[model samples]
Target: MRKFRKDNLVVEIYENRIEMGNSAAEDIADKIKELLAQKDEVRMIFAAAPSQDDMTSNLVKISGIDWNRVIAFHMDEYIGLPRDAEQRFGNYLKKRIFELLPFKEIHYIDNGESDPERICTDYLKKLNEASIDIICMGIGENGHIAFNDPPVADFNDSKLVKIVKLDDVCRQQQVNDGCFKSIEEVPKEAITLTIPVFKRAHNLFCVVPGITKAKAVKRTLEGKISTECPATIIREHHSAKLFLDQDSASLLK
Candidate 1:
């Protein structure tokens, strides 16, 4: 592994995606164990994407995590997809880790009632009820965090959760990831936790792989701290680490 620091963010480049994912899982598992030792339960928010596959898969296999004491939340969800839609972030997590573990609670964002405002208000309340202990996330090909695409990301966003339109690149990424058949099939709007929520989290573990992410990874580490590259904000986080494999780190200097 080649490790270095970019501002407050720690970046680790591994030989392969499997190694990168395993390393991130070990670190995240350690954080969860440490937090559970200090508190009654650990509140965690996760991002659902194909990029997170290896990490989530390995994370669930690690022993001694006390999964029953973990409370789960997903970072974002499409606004109009069916509850059982495979493309739904909530469902993605449910299949990946939520259902595999015995979490104390799994709060899902529901925008199906045609009332995105109410969904945001409800999710915000749940999030505000406790401090987020950790965030397991991935950056989009367009440098987005969660669904906070460049056009809509706000560094000073006051709302904990809000509905926003997905940018063209962000929508195209769904098709690229095979989550949707085409850009036209992707939902244009989504409910996402704001950037402030990420900044406020106690710890962040971002696992990004694939050659498709190389440019975004480069921007995240070298670009200015601005909403234009929302993931760049992770550099300002006190306890954030970015994991990458050769494919994703190819463009980094």
Candidate 2:
């Protein structure tokens, strides 16, 4: 367990799942309160993954959170999947967060039987109009951030959102998470927000849990800034923090 401080942001790691979740929720609630006190609206981006389950659930339970003044955005979605599909990222967010809150609006990538390019363009426009107050995300076992797999990650990518091919590791991860029945059932492609968009957030809270993520977490935290480990870029962001339970941080020296 360690804390990393960059400018006004503080990232604290915990050795316990319950402690990590509780601390992250409290931090998020504090940030929301601070934002609401100074602005009429607050925009946030959320990652939909099993690792975020506890954090999102606790966040929704926070009292005095002005959900009516909040606009929520999701990180990425598999291409060619229906929004209502069991494997859809949209369904995950709806079941875990949006349905549990009174958010003013929730924007998600429209990967539901639409033209891929058109969906990307629409989401790019929506992100441009939003002033993201916080972005909550998790690191993949492959060290990928969002769908920006190691092979395709670009720190200076001009496109806010793009279609990306899922690497083998990433596809297998979805299967392991039970989002799909098997590796072959996972989509090969997805539309994801680029690194620049993630870095554009006023604050970033990265939650990583489980032994499966230990290697990736260690590399990302103690690695050189490069596309090979996309999450390493978080270390460069002035307002980014990483939260990890003991299992995820186990490999860190």
Best by TM-score: 1
lDDT (0 to 1) per candidate: 0.94, 0.87
lDDT of 2 by residue, 127-171 (tens): 899678999999998899999999999999989899999999999
For residues 108-168, could you state the per-residue lDDT of candidate 1 as single tens digits?
8973566899989988989999899999999999999999999999988988899999999
Off by over 4 Å in 1: none
Give the clashing residue pairs of candidate 2, or none. none
Error of 2 at 208 (Å): 0.4
TM-score of each: 0.98, 0.95
Q: Worst lDDT window (10 residues) for model 2?
A: 4-13
